[model samples]
Target chain A: MKEFSLIDTYFRDVSFQRKDVLLGIGDDCAITQIPAGQALATTTDTLVSGVHFLPDADPKAIAQKAIAVNLSDLAAMGAEPAWLSLSLSLPNVDENWLKAFSEGFKELTEYYSIQLIGGDTVQGPLAITITAQGFVAADQALKRSGAKPGDFVYVTGTLGDAGLGLDILQDHTDVDNAEHKAYLLNRLHYPSPRVFAGTSLRRVANACIDISDGLLADIKHILKASQCGACLQLDKLPLSSAMVDSVDQDSAFHYALSSGDDYELLFTVSEEQKSSVDRVLACSNVPATCIGQINGAVGKVDLKFNDESYAYSQTGFEHFNSGESSNKHRNNAKRA
Target chain B: MKEFSLIDTYFRDVSFQRKDVLLGIGDDCAITQIPAGQALATTTDTLVSGVHFLPDADPKAIAQKAIAVNLSDLAAMGAEPAWLSLSLSLPNVDENWLKAFSEGFKELTEYYSIQLIGGDTVQGPLAITITAQGFVAADQALKRSGAKPGDFVYVTGTLGDAGLGLDILQDHTDVDNAEHKAYLLNRLHYPSPRVFAGTSLRRVANACIDISDGLLADIKHILKASQCGACLQLDKLPLSSAMVDSVDQDSAFHYALSSGDDYELLFTVSEEQKSSVDRVLACSNVPATCIGQINGAVGKVDLKFNDESYAYSQTGFEHFNSGESSNKHRNNAKRA
Candidate 1:
């Protein structure tokens, strides 16, 4: 099929439409009206086959993961996603694959109340690039540089589930229980972006980042940006039942600290705003655990387990780094 | 080097800083304030290594082409370029190549007064996906659907030079004059997007589109969107001296009508607005030629040379179509 017809068949009649969109697809450029008194938050992400995801993964799962990862960036910024521009490069035309991928895109777009404004479909090796834009009120965005020395570190949802899921899929780790395997796989394929939790934390949280590069590496982003250190209580790290049931304590802690692709929000809250943060997260119905405290040591992150200092040495995923053995299973590095 | 350091070394210190940009790199999402009373115009385009440009093409030229093509879409919509999000996938990090690429990017972004907002760099085959956003007054942006039956079709600058350049590069065509060869090669490597001409024709033109897929194919987009037809004066198509000197009349016309990558503006103006359009183009210092007149025949395009019916039978570039032998030299299909 021709590129135009391929797009027309699948992406033309997307279910969600926004009034703010002055012009949608089928144009030289999509025109959108950004709401007054709000700032625009934009991010771009690329998912390469065999690097970000298994080459033979289901089309639906690939589509979902692509959109989810971009939305996760918006969520980390405390922005409500409004528009997405997708550049899809494919090896060849596959009608069934396109149908499933479009269905997956349609589902997430409708659920998020965002519209696919414009994009380009090219002929190349399989890869997907999405640039997501959303609205955040002026001076109200959650940033990594906002943390204070006395702030408490928190995370929404559990960490390392997606990493474990990747391991299970890669056959590096195995789970005998069918339900556990399915749960882990689902977590890997379809991550919740924590949109509500993020927007709720806009005024409450001091600093924020999404954990795509593991808790240890990602929290240091906050420290480096905010110019503060952190003391993480390893025992306090939240582990999903699937993770805890499938792995031993050491493995669970290691994955939780150093593995990537969790898509959970890692943020900080000032001491005075702790109650408010708790209330806001409670209203959003996403469990958030305070696992650490920001300190004055400047970029140093100390780990403590059972009241004694703990030493864990494993770096997060970084593209072009040859040292990480599990880099293939992790989401390739994304700067924004 | 790691991904963060790679981005920091090249992209972080860009010189163009816009006041409307609240936050740029290093954030989960870049924040920008859209000017009041203006709408956002967004478009995305991806260029693969082997398909869009020669795999061994200079890194500087590749970067320039990637940015220019996207800005061409913005210009087609009569939007003033503002921000860009780039997704760059590469096989590996070559510091020298990246330096040249980043320099090319810096030159264009500064020239256009646009800022690089946010993006992702991944480890994959060489490809670039750029999402460009600009601004136009609400309801003032030109569109493909605005042409009337009596409108005069016009095109800016010259066509076919880029195509001839590609043919010469691929050894399919030859030019003996050193200056002409250099000119054609430069045309292929650095086709200028008609930014000034497009913005100037905004209120005067009835409809507009950028000619990337040859004048013949791109004009059909206007025809399809406006529900009208056109009779193109083949003899009136502007051709660069380099193109005319290097090829026969028939070959020049074939390249002008069938080959792609011109990046010139193809637009329509009503009879009453013809003088105004001429004055606008003159002020912008860009030559525009009246090439045709829209007719009521509905999607049927007629070609005329020397006031006689021209029997030209060839199609434009379309991805996944096996019929076109020159598709490899053409820029792959881009919907937006």
Candidate 2:
């Protein structure tokens, strides 16, 4: 089939006219008319087969997570998603795969109210690249450099669940319990994007970041940007009940501190405004935990456990540093 | 070395402080404070090794073209580029490659006055994705649907040089010329982004699009959006001197009208604005040519050569439908 005919039959439904979108798909470029008082926040992410995802993973999950992770970036900026472009490279066009993928993509786009603007489709190993564009008011957007020394550090939702989910998926540990399996599977397959929680914190949080690279690593980004250090108390770290029940206390601590893929928000609030944050999150039914406090600008990260300070291993994920392709191995072992 | 340290060492130098950029690289997300009176335009493109480019192509040229192609999308919307985010996937952490890539990237960013923003780096097959953001006044951004019947169409620079350059590089064509080869190579390796021409067109052109997917296919997009049709004068199609000198005139026509990757702006302006466009291009040293005009809604693309309508066999490129991998027999025959 020709490219035009294929697009007309299958991908044409992806086009829709919107007042904000001056031009949708089927153009050399997509154009939008941003309102007078709004600013645009943009981000791009590429998920390569056998690199970022498993080669034979569920297309629905892949599509959802591809857009979800990028939305997480916009969430960190406290922006409202408006438009996106996709560049999908596949070995071949499989009808069933495209249907499932589009279904997954359309659902998330509708949930976020983001329009599919323009995109390019190509032939290659399965690779999906999504660029998400979001909007924010001129003075209302959040940033990573706004945290001060006296700010109270906060996190939305529990950490380490997604990482533990990966462990369960890989069968690294045998879980005979059905509910435990289901919880781990959900965490691995459909990690939540903290857009609502992030938007709510726009006026309250000093600085915000999405935790894709674990609590310690992601929080360090806020520290580096704000030119501050942090003291995270181990006892205050939040972990899922399934994670805590399945693993030993020390293992739970390690997972909570260093496990990645939990798409939650880590933010800092002023010490005086801590109660307001608690009240806001409680009303919204989103869990917000005060894990630590920003300290002096000494360029250090400290963790305290059981009234003792010990040097914890500071490893989350490092791409291309080691010979092993860790993500690929983890995914392949699941199939095995 | 870990991913964080590698990013710090290689990507640390891509820093700039602009008032409009509220935040930049090294943050969870880059935040921009768009000027009050402007609308934001955004786009993303992914170029994979051995797919969009020759696997052995220079890293400098790859970096340059990656930014240039995305900037071309902004220009199509009559937007001026302000920021870019790069998601790079490499097989290894090669210091020399990173230095070269950064240097090439920096040159283009500085030339365009674009700031580096937040992105991710991972280990995978060599692929580079960039999301570019630009700004224009709220009502001044161009769209594909603004062209009206009786409007004169125009294109900047010669077309098909990039496609012909690919032919020469692959040894499909035996042209024994040196300077001509250099020119074609430059066109393919690093096509200029027509920013100045696009900015100037904001005052005169009714609609505009950048030519990435050949004239016939791309012009169809404009026609579809504008609810109009076009009768392209094939005889008036512009061809580079080397193109005509190297191939027969009829073949040159095919290359110019059907070959893709020109990266020049194609636009429509009412007849009354011809003199203004001419004057602007003359003063700015930007080449502009008129080859066609809009017609009534006919729902088809037509071409005329010597007052006789003609049809060509080839359309623009469709990456998935191209049968590139399946054509291994043809490649083998050529090699033998």
Docking class of 2: medium
Give the per-residue lDDT of model 2 (tens digit) for B300-325: 77788987988666767666664653
The reply for model 2, stretches above 4 Å from the true place, is A1-19, A137-140, A324-336, B15-17, B322-336
Candidate 2, chain B, TM-score (2 decimals): 0.93
- The digit string of per-residue lDDT tens for model 1 on B89-171 reads 98999999899999999999999899998899999999999999999996889999999988999999888888888877887
**Candidate 1, which segments miss by more than 4 Å at Cα?**
A327-336, B327-336
DockQ of all predictions against the true structure, Cα-based: 0.86, 0.53
DockQ of 2: 0.53
| Tens digits of lDDT, candidate 2, A174-229 | 45567876887788778888887777788788889898888887888888888999
Question: Quick one: best DockQ, which candidate?
Answer: 1
- Lowest summed lDDT across 10 adjacent residues in model 2 chain B is found at B327-336
Chain A TM-score for candidate 1 is 0.96
- The residue pairs that clash in candidate 1, if any, are none
Candidate 1 positional error at A275, Å: 0.3
Error of 2 at A234 (Å): 1.9
Clashing residue pairs, candidate 2?
none
